[model samples]
Target: MCVVGIMVGLLLLFAAPGVGSLSLGFLFLLGAWFCLWFFPHDLAHHVVGRVLGVGFRYYFLGRSAITN
Candidate 1:
């Protein structure tokens, strides 16, 4: 997520007129989503799960909840 944010910021700063900053931003967001989709065991989800008192399992590729 942080990497995606930084990439988006850089793209916005350097994106050409024809390339469109909005499109670049969207692409960056998409990439972030992809990262999360592929690696859902990230700290963000873990933190949220812990805060919500949910049982969570972190896999190498993704995370899953055991119970609500």
Candidate 2:
């Protein structure tokens, strides 16, 4: 997330005149989308469980995970 923020900041800083605002907004939106894509709730818990060497089961409602 920090990296994405920094990248978007840099992109806005270097964007061409008259288009920087649009570019910045687009970059921010893209960053958010990618973040959600990479960190889907169930996968997040699964990853955390693996890091802690514990077993986990993810329950989802529609598309969101319910973590216990």
Candidate 3:
């Protein structure tokens, strides 16, 4: 999900300039910023978990982990 969010954020950022409307482009940029900001911490958690051999099934409310 973090990977997907990062990819979507990049896509939005790239597409923002071509949107042709200042307001719409700003919205896109904002969305990109949000996506870029939101997902990385969880990704880092996953990375550390993998390094420690701790597996997770999903997040609880996006912060708490539900491990498998």
**lDDT of each residue in 1-68, candidate 2, tens digit only:** 44565555455444533354776667766665555555454566667889999865654447536587
lDDT of 2: 0.58
Q: lDDT (0-100) at residue 49 of candidate 3?
A: 93
Candidate 3: tens digits of C-alpha lDDT, residues 1-45: 789999999999999999989999999999999999997877888
**Residue-level error in angstroms, candidate 2, position 63:** 24
Task: Name the 10 consecutive residues with the lowest summed lDDT in model 3.
Answer: 58-67
Top model by lDDT, which number? 3
Candidate 1 structure quality by residue, lDDT tens digits, 1-68: 64565555555444433454777757765665555454444666677988999896644544555677
Which clashing pairs does model 3 show?
none
Number of clashing pairs per prediction, in order: 0, 0, 0
lDDT of each: 0.58, 0.58, 0.90
lDDT of 1 at 24: 72
